[model samples]
Target chain A: MLSPLLSSSIKYYLCFMQTVIIGSGNVAYHLAKAFVLNRIPLAQIFGRNENELSKISGELNIPYSTETLQKADLYIICVSDHSVEDVSGTITTKDCLVAHTSGSLPKEILKGDYRKASFYPLQTFSKSKALDYSKIPFFIEAENEEDRKILFEIASKISDNVMESTHEKRKYIHLTAVFACNFVNHLFARAKEISDLQVIPFDYFLPLIDETVQKIHEIDPKSAQTGPAVRNDTRVLQLHEQLLQGESLEIYKTMNLSIKKMYQLP
Target chain B: MLSPLLSSSIKYYLCFMQTVIIGSGNVAYHLAKAFVLNRIPLAQIFGRNENELSKISGELNIPYSTETLQKADLYIICVSDHSVEDVSGTITTKDCLVAHTSGSLPKEILKGDYRKASFYPLQTFSKSKALDYSKIPFFIEAENEEDRKILFEIASKISDNVMESTHEKRKYIHLTAVFACNFVNHLFARAKEISDLQVIPFDYFLPLIDETVQKIHEIDPKSAQTGPAVRNDTRVLQLHEQLLQGESLEIYKTMNLSIKKMYQLP
Candidate 1:
């Protein structure tokens, strides 16, 4: 409700606070859904790709624009790492606090004549598969305390596991995430490939993979580590190497050596 | 619940329908616990080391044996992979079925005039942590139909997910487990090392790790894979490699290359 005494512009700002999400990739799509799911005043979603944009627009039943300029109190630039700066630049949002959803990019990349921050959800999100947003750890960053609070407040609304991180600390989160999420998934992929070759369904490794992750939840992965390299089982290691060739062979050897050195195996 | 037999020899076999588990290691300890938990007749546990063996004996309230030959209908050799042959050799249980719990080793390894078999549980068992044996896949194999049925009956009693796996298939499962469990855990370990160096606790990677494992349950890992390497983002890949050094760098580079090659990225 707008008060008669209040200025029209001030009343407009007070009456409605809206968010415009940029991009339509996995992170963008999931974030958009989560924002809507939480009723976070999501006004518009902008996607460069017409097909993907329409897909998101239809799914969320929200107004979307391919136009660079969209009016919203908060503009979340959720695009690829390379295009984050470009997306921020294209958003002609003024006075609004703009943030990019990137784990690696610094907050400064959000280039607009407005306050900026990086609103990074530290999790691997797939668009179709809905993630538990409340469980997702969010790393928010901004220069000013006021703007930071605004970002933090909005982020906290979505996730209980929210915290302010410096660009330095947040970037390490990105690098480490690559190892944990990306590299770990690759290991699963390689392992799956190996199983597929042997006419084994990928399901054979599910229990083992679940336990591997579950261990870190209870104990440090360092002590939870086990296998040929840790046990110094050169015979089995040789047998495994015999099955792997080319790139996988190199990976097995390299990781084996690392594991051996990490544990200082005999 | 045994009916009286006319002869002492028939009564000896009928009265002692029990299992003797050899070795007090992770697999043995967990198997012993699971057996009792399921109300299976686990009569004795044997370990070369008196200290560890006594710990298991006292905990399970089962008789501890230093002697290799403990009377039971079945003998399960649950020693290390390398020690399976030697452990099976030491067991002198005639007529009773002797099964070594090893994914890689064949049932023939068990020496003496005993019906040989393999009863491998496909999981990472830690003695301190009790696993849900019902969910763990139990792989069984035996020399003869009678011995096989005995192994199957016992394995099925503890686990619903029981299957017959030949030595050939079991070895492949063992190899794949190394890739999925051992290699995946090392990635977590390395990620933890990176986080530790930067004074960041390993909690941040927890959600991502959980999701990575979760994704495989819903979708195939090869299709479920996401990251800079799969996306062919050279920029972020280069950045990740730059942050990593020594063995970590090699691991990053090798994995990145494998992911790229696996996806047939340029």
Candidate 2:
């Protein structure tokens, strides 16, 4: 018969195992910090950039490296879109579960002599702002049953919202994210530029921005769309076009026309 | 010299006079409710839509109307884009401070044979959701000196951030708001559609959306932009195109190319 003390000791040993994070970018930095804050031991952080590695290590008080991938239960690969495949090619962890944190790239990118998976945090990140990972959604994808279970277990520890998704679905979600976040932000920047040039206070636009966002939380955006474009107020549109005489004007007209066409509003 | 009893009565009467709101659209509804909550009495609400007028009147316990403009200290015209001229055309209240709530249309749209100005709330409004008017910016404009002061005083009663802007400036601000709010929301809707089609939970994209907006408060949007397009990850871009297909694919490619060209990212 097994002793109760021995069984308890085994459980404790398993719970104390370290987690390794590969690649040192925004996602990696935020994830590592969250793990450390949660008191989960961060075994190592591996990457090519010594400066970034050092900065992350110093900030989190975690170990850093520009060396080979360390053996751990899980190794998270966080890198740029192009760098994913190249970095995956370097890791030789056949037994350890390896995952990449990318929205668009497929899990096949990690195809090699390894137990591969994905732990995509569906969010934008910046080095300047500290993220609340608990609020972030984690999308987990794996090749097999056991690996998938392990990946889900790990992801669930940090975030409240965790789910299993295939690469095809994740890719579609990523494309949508590009439109929603990146493209939308670019639109705001363009708007800011136009407003600044006219010497108008940018704060004037914030109310509209806040309302536009708040509206969709309650209604469909198609039904929620409002503007001179939606109304096809030709006189106002023409007057606006005349005022904004540049590249931005062209963009404005194109977007306005698109909105009008979408809604079939004149 | 005035008698003490008569002077005290007049002071009490002036203090008890309530501000009246004209028209029962989104702006009028929100403003009226806000005024009521602020303990500023909403003496009356007027609109052609009897159902809407009665609903607001009943909810706020204010008087309802489908009648012509009555004598009031302030008259705010909150109507559709095309109706601004028609609605204000009949008013001949030279003594009353008159204003219109429109971003694109000028204050002169209310240039009846009266004191004309604008009380344009720089925010989108829906009939369903209650808005915090204190957070919403108010743009004040007037044709003459005395009317401008009255407009400013009325606006200051609700919002803290009030500004004097020209018609040309307000028009440009409205145009910029189209990009920031309406256009951005369309992109979000597009993203949501794609994600829904792919069977991914819409919640997955919320983190990304929240972060992108939060980042803007910290840094310039030009610096905050991220994703495969900004990084010039052509491989991921091609894969994204393959996944999107048809018009969405075209939109994805066009936007990606535009972002790449803007940043000169490779």
Chain A only, candidate 1, TM-score: 0.92
Once model 2 is optimally superposed onto the true structure by TM-score, how far is the C-alpha of residue B45 displaced, in angstroms?
2.2
Residue A227 Cα positional deviation in candidate 2, in Å, after optimal superposition: 1.9
In model 1, pairs of residues that clash are none
Local error of candidate 2 at residue A231 (angstroms): 2.5
How far off is residue A70 in model 2, in Å?
2.6
Q: Distance from true position, residue A181, model 2, in Å?
A: 1.2
Q: Candidate 1 lDDT, tens digit per residue, A1-266?
A: 22454334443453378878888889888888887787776788888787998999899887887865577788888888889887778767677888888887788877779888889898888765668888889888887765676676677768888888988888788889988998888888888888888898878678778887887888778888888789898778887887789887898999999998898875
DockQ of 1: 0.73
Question: How does model 2 do on interface RMSD, in angstroms?
Answer: 1.9
DockQ of each: 0.73, 0.60
For candidate 1, give the lDDT. 0.82
TM-score of chain A of each: 0.92, 0.90
Model 2: CA > 4 A from native? A1-18, A245-247, B1-20, B245-254
Model 1 ranges off by over 4 Å: A1-15, B1-16
